[model samples]
Target: MPQNIYLEDYTLVQPHSNFVIAGGRVFIKKWTSLSFNCTIVTGNHKPTVGLNQRIIERLHINDIEKDVVIGEDCWVGANVTILSGTMLGRGSVVGACSLLNKSSPPYAVLVGTPAKIVGVKFSLEQILKHESNLYPEHERMSRDELEVLFEKYYKGLKSMGTDYLSPEEKMKSMQYANMQYKI
Candidate 1:
């Protein structure tokens, strides 16, 4: 059983049974909030040639294990089930009763059974300002200071290393991408 769990500061997790099990890691970064009845499972029974669903009968097959990473400033709502190999990036918000089975980019607002990215919590510019304010006590910065801040903070969670697209731009991109799916 692997016991390499990393929970950072200012994390709030509500009471629940079997919240996190052993045999893998669960890294919940700083400023995260997990609501009640949330389960983070890190191991799953591997499918075998035999049609036995019982673990005892499938003992010859090894279980698949992977880490679950919930990044900083995240909000996981009630009854969320995060499976193995899932990565919820920084500043994400998972809505209630969501089943997160895939990785998400930073600041993604996810909902539904498979947990699709609906939107982001804040704009990149605002997030940059928020991060700058966090560095030294929440205070406004001068123009030059802001420039320096951007230079340093651009590499961090605030910037996804891409241009912040407008809604129309996003729609266009999605439309272009969806063309591949058409028969």
Candidate 2:
């Protein structure tokens, strides 16, 4: 972890998820989840060209500021390297072992080196609506409560022939349903 690294309203689970970010920015939006072994580095690679020329000046620049912005309700898989200025949009999924070098569009599933959009997670409207409710904190629910909540929401989704829910909406709904059952 580095100074001024912002992980706003997100959840990071797993032991010892270390990062080396020098003068870099990391923004994890609301309800997003970052799994184990995720690293973001701001240092540029060693310059291979001549040191005197202005064209090679960028090569010697060691302290390049790289910012990583992960949007709302995103699921970042384990061992992911989010490079400088990489923006993953709302409701997107980054697959495991991927290197994100560019900005991803909202709701897109991205994977691979120089990650490409593999699929869409959900419609923008659905993401916005659903994420308004669910969040990672719902994992705090007791086993029995979680079971009941899952059964209720997942069953409803199955009936509707849908397979996904935004992280925040899903968690909040579960927590709400659990509370209802308790009373």
* Candidate No. with top TM-score: 1
Write candidate 1's Cα lDDT for 23-48 as tens digits: 67888887788999899988787677
C-alpha positional error of residue 126 in candidate 1 after TM-score superposition, expressed in Å: 1.1
For model 1, the stretches where C-alpha displacement exceeds 4 angstroms are 20-22, 56-60, 135-183
Clashing pairs in 1: none
**RMSD values, in order shown:** 14.0, 10.8
In order of appearance, the predictions have TM-scores of 0.67, 0.63
Q: How much is the lDDT of residue 62 in candidate 1?
A: 66
